[model samples]
Target chain A: MENKENILEVRNLSINFKTYAGTVQAIRDISFDLKKGETLAIVGESGSGKSVTTRSIMGLNATNADVVDGSIEFDGQDILQLDEKELSKLRGSKIAEIFQDPMTSLDPTMKIGRQVAEPLMIHQGLSKEKAMAKALEMLKLVGITNAEERINDYPYQFSGGMRQRIVIAIALVNYPEILIADEPTTALDVTIQAKILELMKELQTKINTSIIFITHDLGVVAGMADRVAVMYAGKIVEYGTVDEIFYNPKHPYTWGLLGSMPTLDTNEDVLPSIPGTPPDLLDPPAGDAFAARNKYALKIDTIEQPPFFKVSDTHYAATWLLDDRAPKVTPPADIVKRQEHFNKTKQG
Target chain B: MLDKDAPKILEVKNLKQYFNVGRKDEVRAVDDITFNVHEGETFGLVGESGSGKTTTGRAISHLYEPTGGEIIFEGKDVSKLKTKKDEKEFRSDIQTIFQDPYASLNPRMKVKDIIAEGIDINNLAKDKADRDAQVEELLETVGLNKEHANRYPHEFSGGQRQRIGIARALAVKPKFIIADEPISALDVSIQAQVVNLLKDLQKKRKLTYLFIAHDLSMVKYISDRIGVMHYGRMLEIADADELYAHPLHDYTRSLLSAVPVPDPEFERQREIVDYDASVESDGKQRKLVEIAPNHYVRAADDEIQMYKDRLNS
Candidate 1:
């Protein structure tokens, strides 16, 4: 239904983690697609399988995590069946990754130039000198002003924001087709967080690379996402365009997420959090896991998982409330009022 | 807006907190930053990472010695206090709530003992029964059950752990507090819960807070008057409403512009501040002056000249 430019497609993906406690189902029957040059933001609270889903794409999930079902189709090949040798060849060259902490992702002993050139050397078969020059080019591409000089410095010499930029440069060094960023800016300050998000959007345009952006911040989702998939208890309960998720949210969990966001406009109101915590993934419920905490949960929601009902052409939600047989329901009046209030004040 | 009728609880003038790195040059973390906490009001100190917001908070609570300036608390000069007894008395009056609840709270101890540690040391509570009663009252005030005092901080959620931190601060019965980025470490959903709890507690206790954080949206949600700092200097300090509605300084405006509006439609169309354009000429050399009521800004000489020259052009 998009612009005939699907780069990556995930179908009914299920993954389980072999922890000492038990087999933890981190991802459950989740499916979504990333279009060329578009951002598909996977927004969820911590431990909601947002990162696990992306990590699975890169085959970077811990050894304990087993991909139980479904397939990830990338450039016409199923990624689930790839061996480490194959995955290694594909990773950093085709599916580069930028993780949460830039410090850990970067090597302490190595120079920044050598680290960025690692992918270029391995993937492009370029010489050390050529790769180093290309690494410095990538550094400048991500807006490092004095990239040529700073290439010799270690990762410790850079600030948090600068380190994150270096990570981005490394992620894009091989000119990857799909860039997977796992909470890349969560550790940064808000101002720097904004700059990085803006840089990502700018970089995506220049390279025409599809991005799988994973984060818990709705603020960042608002700034850069083209499509949003709301995850809850190892499942994507809502998948839609940014407008549908923000303006006409169907899932009750999405409502809680939207309501929890604190804005300058929400000055005097006592910010509401979702009543209870997310359901335990170790022993997840059969039906909608969100029913336990959802104030607007229907009986059907508790009995059986709702099908992906169409709200609009490109928007769908796993909620029974969107059913034609169901009675009409509206979001909390406070939510409606807050949306209007935010709209007026949010614009300059 | 506050009990302007009441006396000032904490007043800082020309406060300076300088740190010497390996070399001779000093990192002026808090350089000549001035602000005051009314008898009861949440005065927010906001900035990005290196803006010295936490340093200012630490200096205000006397955790760090100021290189120069005066800290007058309740009509006494805190900077001039030399004796341990006087400093200990000052410490009792102004407590601190650190950012990481896990790092701040002693993991080995139970919540009750942790809360009781300060009061017991200072002899704020006379008897064992009095100490237990005070702990219970503080626990209940922070919306925790009386039994929660027996449990360790690890047992509670992030928001609950922060509440325990709050209860600990309240145990000593401090009038003025420096809550340094209390909720920045919590989850996004739980951040609102903690912010609301802090606001409710502020109303109940009439506590004056020097709330320090990196998030402007959150700072706006909590602060009465906001002081913005950049590169160790107070860039701007104005009423929260006025600062957000009309940020005067280019740097302040740029900071405000960076705060992502949490609406999908608005975010796409919204104009983000370009880091290159805003601070092109000014690195660390920006002259700051108060242009209006409680609003100060820093800009390079060329930028200042350009502003003047443009107005005349």
Candidate 2:
């Protein structure tokens, strides 16, 4: 794991969006690195800055968005400092993205073959005939049946699941080094979502592309991600390997999220949900954004923001509870059960 | 969770809802499905998109006229109501909470007016002051403050808008509520909040709910008895725990297997059970048969014994 190279490194990235109401600080200063050929999932509720962080990597932020600070380094280049032309060249061919809704992602009027081929023509300068042939092959790679015949069909001809497959094909057609999928399968049903997630894993091994998977579903994250970053109120509260985040979570927000979701073995009548909504980002909170909802919040949590407390070489969490002086508090019963179950599995 | 002696609150017998009848693109959204909801119980209907669960909820709420069959509510046939007075009374007895809070709410109306629409129509209030007071109380009932009544729907968050929708539904004092994917549009943190609110309200008001959703885990948690729907048919129905523990139908098993649990170790080892749709279109006659006590599975005469055998093993 130490020998693996970091394909993309984001450092102290902060973004603010100017609106009529005020300036909304969408992404607070945060940093993380993506290892080559690994799937790093950013899990958070809506407006938690997971999408903003990923969108900035593609230089796809809105015109009103202001990158206040930080650097996005990829391939010996600072992506945040790249010119429009340079960024355009880097996108699609080097760092392609798949959006949430497949229905709106692809051009409805254009044929599926043309949509997939356009990126290749633009990024790689492939001939029309050559790009179309490659597009057909990519379609087949994505598990579309009768790819030759279906390549000529429009986006509307395919089902929701099939349309997402085409979206994946378009993103991976150029064999990009990084594939940023923003809630790729949220719109699809569970059965279709399962197939798509499986297809993604299979394709990742074949192409060896580092994926930045963004979604709010913890279940999907558990199945797909090698590493997990849990975000709340525009800041990453905790991050670690999937095992550490699921089995030994240190942050109160993470505990609330895990306990809120009922599993098959869950027998409790009431869920241990986090109380209150997220803080308004326009004003931004004074201290820790999660302190208002966290039951284990310390007095310092209300006045001073806690820095990252290292739990291990790979695991880090921002919580006052990790301080030596803070009293030890038990996590929810469900999370303790999860830890017990994980240990049992590890031993067996 | 459900009492065996509880009286039936709503019953649909071979209900059918079809669009574009006799056309090339005719869609049998809800076809020949039968189920009954007991009084004061959450009956969850779950299926994938385009599986007629939403259509079933709409048909029960009278959002669409059923193409065929009877919807018996509290011993009265809903389709047989002839008088305007009877229809108006029926309208107030059952309410629907739509899936999307953003679209279900009218942006122009104030929160108070949105909730009071039902009160005004039912003549439940005495005067304007009484109406305002009732609206304020309803808002507080759903975990909102009275100050929110003056604001428009656009000003509130997704969770708040959903709370307003619940308040409006409860404003009519309906005996039964049809919540069609109520919490699917909400965030995970907020989803639990809304589900808890619904459960609390049910205990307080003794309201029966026809909760329809595609999320299998959530449906299982909230529902006392669960019904699994497929293309246009009810594939299985049983006690919530029974259905999860011993799913008899192939489609039910596939749906259950496909649900990604939050446990990483369990998820990695989970195998997705694929259902072959060709088996359903094989032209064999099928019906919902009880294989175990109170456990129903859709099967043909030849497949019934196979299902029972599988259950025993």
Candidate 3:
């Protein structure tokens, strides 16, 4: 089921931030691929370097950030090698990003229409009137009503959900090949979140743009992503189709994450929370970063980092338990029951 | 003495909190909402932004005087507490933990002083040494070290600052607490830790909590009963399991359906239920009607029967 045509191929990408305390190894040798028109979700806890990896793709990392090694190949061309003039051309026109908070991202002084139209004017060299006409069309496409009149208003005048709609319109105004949405719906309510997700799914189908959706919410990932990459300590611990990652997960970290999340279907008390906090990235562990917190961790997990073991042609996981000589270990009982429930639901 | 059928610690009757009242465009933040929270139970109030969950919480805590209705706490009508002594007593028994830990805490104040503010105001402590000891114990109660009391709020992380916030709320030995979206600001991993901490604290102190949050799943995990609100109106109120398993109201069903499950297969196949209030209400006056043994739904007379039929179906 693998697609040959790749839009973004990240290989052994290592990133570090030069902090005053010390060098923080934010991302360590992470690699993944995004096929054309596929929605790939990067899911992890806050400090797991999900944002760092995605931002590096957009060349939006902090000034203290260093791309230690590796390459980011976008549509057969390495983006890291592109000059500033060339890179700016590709940024909004080819790879646009929508951040979590629209209030901070938008300029309070400017009107919503101009903010959306500015990208078109810069990238496409369209006249102000033409750009605004396209912006209004984009706003309507994102399900905003009274687009013609509302486009003249400032960001604060719109509601939280409407502001997000404006942000989405701005991002998709250029019809970028890739849309990097980092927790776009985290700030909105459930009803609004559902509407935004539906809008994004509809727009993706219409524009045929690959999306790198970054979120800590697995449920959001489940709804939106075709493929899932579970990151930990700046590495893709498990990469597979959404089904494989959710139902047939291999890594212990992935199991912990699934067990930790409370669902409407279950009445289990004490959501089996991962016992320990994420490892401090300033002094990253030598072995698996999740070793300390992982209950089913093997002795080898504490001694050496596990390589990505192939579970299938499309599934890969980094865990010592996947080794041939390692003892067979099943997932937590809750996860097992959840999968069984999923199977039943699927068949029913 | 607490009983299995204990009397309600809090009863909000026809509570109304309107912003910009008597104006051309008045906003009814909490429009005639009524509910009872029994002792030692977690009553979760959940809704989206602009839904008045926070306002309801603030009104119940006496942070904002209700424009209408009575908030009866421990047989005392707190909405009309006029005397300074009565207000002080109310403040001691009912405390709040604000959502944004960073903004709620005074950055310039030491942690000890922050936690001790309630104790000092209520005169719960005898002297400076007594206040220090009380602060230390409160700190330990919320899973923080006593040494943390000497530091400022800026020195702590978001989770730690929230723990300090919890300590501050608990310093007065309050019988009830209003935790307004407390864990929403923390990270996923830290969220669980704070939740676990809250649960443990609740069990230890036998405290009644009015937990306000938007995340339905987390609310279910933490709360025994939940009240669903939308646009300043209570839509439904029921046991968490019952509400999730058999949601009767269209708005309740839609809200439940909108919650993203972590399972990919379910999410892919799940259909979103849209409940339009204007269409459903049909310009009829709606009231909070009891449908089941303990379940309540906001519906018109005709819609109430429809909900009953839907529930039976």
Candidate 4:
């Protein structure tokens, strides 16, 4: 909660894509903070701007995308104003990024060792020999046993999970203060996903680095994140500590997401979907972005978008239902069931 | 892996699908693994990407002929069948639902034609109208309307396209089908919808399925019996709930422990740990052993020793 604890902060961040058809508002006044040595996971369905929000921080937004407003302040300095060259130094040095697909992120033509060494070569001014040695060390750090031999192998030679570990190694080789992982485990199988998460968690502890884990899987969020920000239609629908976001959920959209999780407690017969697709960012609907889909949408919810109301010290959600004036509504019955199931599971 | 009593709709025993790579070592993709799908049962085959779950599914469907083992579908030895007539008969009874719904469906073909292709090939329908009616019925069965039959494969969401693929599979009226992680590529919410649709269709059509996936939770939900595979071998097999409740195998135990529960209370409580170190401890080895009725597991030496001692005593 302390100002000094905030490693990265986004204030009223708004991003738009200049498409051939029309300007698409991808991120609408989204704001959140990542504390030092902590992970802030922005969770959402596809096109929820979860990836876009983090992508903006690394200055990795699409070519057509424009940062119309807001500032991404990192280490008390606004990174948005930094030039491409300055930002280039900051990227993969002070701030590193791990993409969704490791296969694509890694260069197939080059040796995995050389690909990892390139960042070290450019930023740290290390010799190829030193960079290669450091790269092998990093690969070992990521739990790749035969790092020395495997370093010579191409991305195609490695498995999906192994490829992801290689990507993690590349990201962490720079020893960045902030490592932004965008759906790092989505491409992996569950066991492999678990391994990747574990490696990241272990490495996070070892380095004491801040991680901005951007993922749609709330299940993964529970295991990985210290803080969770639920994004919907270019907005931070809910933001809180992992416990608050998952256990004592305030937002209906959050509840819907939790309910949709195919856990043991979820009833086999009735599977709940969010009812419809995410709103078109090209022309987003006025009021709460989730209003149309929300079954418990209030009269005001359809007319006015709600500001984030405080639930706990570190918890807040942008839903009128959280408002005192907005009638007191309980979360979905299934979420309560999940809580009970969780309680029983933990108790035993 | 083949059960004795039950009528095996599809028996894929010791199915080995080896892909010869460049030089050095031949990739043992689908090693000696055997399983049988009883009539009206969903036999779940689950593993990681390189674990050969997809290969096993493909081998069962005869999309790729197994280099070893027998694929006895409804009574015929699919792998041994050299004659075209026998292969055609086998293909008619066995169908496949691929992972990528978008890529798997023919872009140029209309939905009607896509579904009706199998029927036309097999001559299941008497005439064009009969085939149209059959296609429409198949469409309705998979949650798509008959009117959408004229639409192309491109004119649908990922979920709808999967449904069309399901429709295409169901068109041949195959008693058995292999759904190769059909829901993995879909959205989380959309995944359940498709999973439930598969379950519902299985019940209504009295269809047997070889549902292959890496998701334990979804696999537990839809499968009658779940097979946990690692590397190229099935580590455990048990009734859906039983497998989750009492995972006997070391690999299965580790796998279940690895699955991140969605609830923060549970998720926060359980920190996932690296497994390779544990698996390699003391240079121990484990073998797949049946411990309970209709339940088999790969146990460590210590566990196996205890079992052996108990059995001898």
- Best model per lDDT: 2
Interface RMSD of each: 1.5, 0.8, 1.2, 1.7
Output the worst ten-in-a-row residue range by lDDT, candidate 2 chain A: A263-272
Candidate 1: how large is its RMSD? Answer: 3.6
Tens-digit per-residue lDDT, A24-50, candidate 2: 999999999999999999999999999
How big a share of the true inter-chain contacts is recovered in candidate 4?
0.58
A278 Cα displacement, candidate 1 (Å): 2.3
Q: List the residue pairs that clash in candidate 3.
A: none
- Candidate 3: residue A46 Cα off by (Å): 1.5
Model 2: pairs clashing at backbone N, Cα or C within 3 Å = none
Task: For residues B202-265, write the lDDT of model 1, one tens digit per residue.
Answer: 7877888888887778888788888888777777777888789877666677788888777876
Model 4 chain A — which ten-residue stretch has the worst lDDT?
Answer: A264-273
Sorted by DockQ (best first), the order is 2, 3, 1, 4
Query: Can you give the lDDT of residue A9 in candidate 2?
Result: 96
If ranked by lDDT, best first, what sequence of candidates would result?
2, 3, 1, 4
| lDDT-better candidate, 2 vs 4 | 2
Where does model 1 exceed 4 Å of error?
A: A324-327, A337-348, B1-6, B21-23, B82-85, B125-130, B274-290, B294-313
Give a tens-digit lDDT track for model 4, residues A1-348.
Answer: 334478888999999999987999999998888898998888887788887788788887889989899999997689888889888999989999998999899888999889889899999999999999999899899888788788888899988889999898888888899999998998887778888898899999898889998887878898888889988888988888887777778888888888777885454576676776677889999899899989999888878889989987889988888777777766677878656765676679
A85 Cα displacement, candidate 3 (Å): 1.6
What is each predicted model's overall lDDT from 0 to 1? Answer: 0.83, 0.93, 0.89, 0.82
Q: Candidates 2 and 3: which is better by DockQ?
A: 2
Write down the TM-score of every candidate. 0.91, 0.99, 0.95, 0.89
B1-313 in candidate 2: lDDT tens per residue? Answer: 5778899999999999999999999999999999999999999999999999988988887778889998999898888889998888889989998889999999999999999999998899999999999999999999999999999999999999999999999998999999999998999999999999999999999999999998888998999999999999999999999999999999999999999888788888989999998999999999999999989999999999999998998
